[model samples]
Target: MPLEEIQHWTWVFGRAQQMMLDYSLREIEKARTNDPETPMSGFAAAGGAMLKAQTDFWSDSLKLWQRFLMPEEAPSEARALSEEIGRRADRDKRFSAPAWRDSPLFDLVRQSYLLVSDHLLKGVDAIDGLDARQKERIRFATRGFVDAMSPSNFPLSNPVVIEKTLETRGENLLKGLDHLLSDLGRGQLTHTDSGAFEVGRNVAVTPGKVIKRTPLYELIHYQPTTPQLMRTPLVIFPPWINRYYILDLNPEKSFIRWAVSQGLSVFIVSWKSADAGMKDVTWDDYILRGQIDAIDTVRDLLGVDAVHAIGYCVAGTTLAATLALLAARGEADKVRSATFFTAQVDFADAGELTLFVDDDQLSVIDALANDGFLDGRYMAATFNLLRSRDLIWNYVQNNYLLGQDYAPFDLLYWNGDTTNLPALWHRSYLTDLYRDNKLVQPGALSVDGTPIDLSLVKTPAYIQAGREDHIAPLQSVWKLTEHFAGPMRFLLAGSGHIAGVVNPPTSGKYQYWSHEGTAATLSEFLEKAVETKGSWWPDWIRWIEALDDTRVAARAARMPGKGRLKALEDAPGSYVRAR
Candidate 1:
């Protein structure tokens, strides 16, 4: 249902309840007047009953509140607050609720906010009789409500905004207004200053050439930087929801360039940003016309029977499906090995993203996509809501309230560079994978006249999941091992979706966990895991080397037109730069 309609009905229900209470009070008075011969004790008893009901309601609320303040078992929020206090004493103010230290009143406000949030979360857990979908909706709605009510959202309540305003003599407020007006004109929220970065010049600046082009995507073969090359080539399939430049953000962080330097020929599939003309493109088109086509191009260019493949996010899921189709066709040998990064083929426990997906929500989305495609802004908004405090409200407070401009952050820059989804493909994905969860069932999904059964894929697999990923939970991604009939290796990385994947060995930032053997459950895997410092890239490199036994002599890098595929354009191709 529409939020406005829900609000309207809630108002009507409240008024009806108030009217019933007033009618009951009026009846009590009339009964007392009509029964004067009888005692006034009956009227007193009735009044006491009403008072007792009100008391019971508050008594339950108090008990719920007490759970938040339990000394023996402090909630996660309480522990977080204590840690924040220590950090604040050391002059760290990176956290959102800086006003908590301004005054006891502000501190009380923070406590009340946390207490209510904790209670609402617990209340959802305590709820019974509701189906999984209903409970998910309740939890999601409650989180949204709590996020909106945070103290930092209001100017008067947030000390950082107040401090900035006073420091700038209210000039900050004027700039903030300008920022708001600019974003409104654009019809989207600005996560980063768009003017600070450009696509081909500084962002996706790696030296490469577009070797092939199709209606759905572009195939870019990066120039090799190593002295010798592995016999097997590598092809990457990035998620179509965002630009492929995320993997090749810049020189310092470009995974594509790193792969090339590691003596491996790299090829990436850059999906076109869908529009009205491409609305008819289906999931089969993405698999056959996009991924499978790119695989064929790479195999012909390298003159190899098979090539190593890597997939990230949604692309990873599609790659798995495509492999299944290949297996059914007795052509599974086309891919030497498969690696999946933060992707879920089994959507049984897809985490919070599933909360906004159901028959009703899909219908609403279908109506919006009647124009041929779901606008990129809508997709971006949905993702921002998943991390509203970090992605939405933080930007709101910074750009609107504090009047601060966003600095040039590569990840946020890539985030703002959104892409639209074709109507048919988007609808099919939500209906089949998310709602119906058809990918796990044999013959449930078909592509290019072939039935897909993931177990038929006998190629060795390497799967990595982010421990803190909100979109594809570790538990969900780990389930991929159960479906594959080949040898499998699973790695659990630290941080959320983007950070976890982009982590480099030089950064020494996040740690990853590895186990010798697969366990029965995700928890069991974690129980027997060993922590390793630095990035998982080196580990992956070693694994890839083990898969390929042939090490060839040093050779000069292949040019774009040198291959039979022929060059279409320069690197970072046209599709990625299309709006």
Candidate 2:
């Protein structure tokens, strides 16, 4: 065999060897299911399950027809199948179409698909030889298959698609074809209309000035809304994986706007999207160069000893390391208070996002980044696949099947916007954090030669997590409390990662739960937690106020073009506009 072919088969065989090491053959035999009806119960017994699935499918189809022929009679064999379909449709938006229930042929399509999907997942669960991580990867792969085969994704199978075609006299298909071609040109599935929003013009319009610029980041000092300003300035360290505009997206939904209005000076780190030039940047460089550089600039420009800090998503992960770095350097007081938005410090239960880090997939990704940067499209696709039904297929059905244009949504626009990761940083992030699970360990990792110890971080922290967050599970975010030495406040918010963090008071959307003190587990905290009616922003600002409410007369000192650091341009600086 050729050398490359031998290597490929070796990697494939390596997975089988892993199962042997992870579990004993005796355990696998003991745990193996004997249930004949359990489709594909175990790999060893797959022959029986395959025969059963084929016979069952035929048997169920016959029963469905019998039930249709005889109306008011005894209970039908397909009654359980009918009930399952109804239950799935109740919670899932995809099968909620009226035609699905009212029409027989369409209903049959939906029912058959659900039956197979359910069994496929169940079969994955029944498999005995694999570990939890291995099983999860199987389930994820199975779900992709199920989601792709969904009746709603195809024009012929979907009732809505047929209706649109007939109503538009086949014009919908023509439009759909055009949309498909356009999306192909863009090289991504568009969740929102292209050119829907522009930074500094409409979306990131909360008035601010670019006070400082480094190779890694641009610091924006937001124009304060109140006549009197709080003593401590607020700096937001958004993840370099995305543009910083998510926090500053439009005046209404912008968290930056709401914070500025509450008499606080806000500074944001606008990360330069990685290109070939940034191939050598590492995690430590991100901490010291991007985050730390932004922090020190805010201090130097505002003349404050300490500043309030906020980190979202991956930045939150980096922020935890930055705090530990600061503590090791005896400069913990540089940040007066810390707030984390849907960030994960502990990768122990990092949710479905870990699938990319498994099954020797990291090596493939490393090779792809041979140009010094991993294309942001790879990361975007991973996130979209997490909720493929909504993010991927929803667009496929709407744009290619039913022929509809994307709506102008700021959040969706931001979600579609991609940013590249430096190859070294990407590799370190996977091996060090996701693979070795080292960030939570004190001194297991180092930044600029200093060992990191999270237990030494004495700064008060407000950690907010989304109950529905898939990328960073609530349980995973909760683990950060165990690592921090500071008094921590954990707030559970409604919605997923982005909506939960960007929720504003004026919107009057979504609720939050806050507990007075820490608990042994998240469940324990929820037992005594108080559930509020609106956004968590107001409650959060009050927490900041309690820390230091000292106010000083507002000065008209924020001219963008004139400062010590000096404004290179405006708020959403050129760095964010890169690629």
Please tell me which predicted candidate would have the highest lDDT against the true structure.
2
What lDDT does model 2 reach?
0.81
lDDT of 1 by residue, 1-579 (tens): 354553454345435544655654555565556566545446445454543344333333333233333434646554565445435433523233545555434543455456456657766755656788788888888998888887777788777788889999988889989999998998888988788899998899889889888889989988777667888889999999999999999887888888888988888999999989997899999899888888988887777899899999999999999889899999999999999999999999998888777777788888889879988888888999998877888878888999997788878889988899998899899889987899999998889778899999898899999989998999999999889898888999999788889887778889899998768788899999999987888889988999995756444335555667677888999999998
Checking candidate 1 for backbone clashes, the offending pairs are none
Q: Give the TM-score of candidate 2.
A: 0.89
What local lDDT score does residue 121 receive in model 1, on the 0 to 100 scale?
71
Deviation from native of the Cα of residue 317 in model 1, angstroms: 0.6
Which regions of candidate 2 fall more than 4 Å away from where they truly are?
1-66, 69-77, 556-562
lDDT of 2 by residue, 302-326 (tens): 6789999999999999999999999
Alpha-carbon local distance difference test for all models: 0.80, 0.81
Cα-based lDDT at residue 76, candidate 1: 59
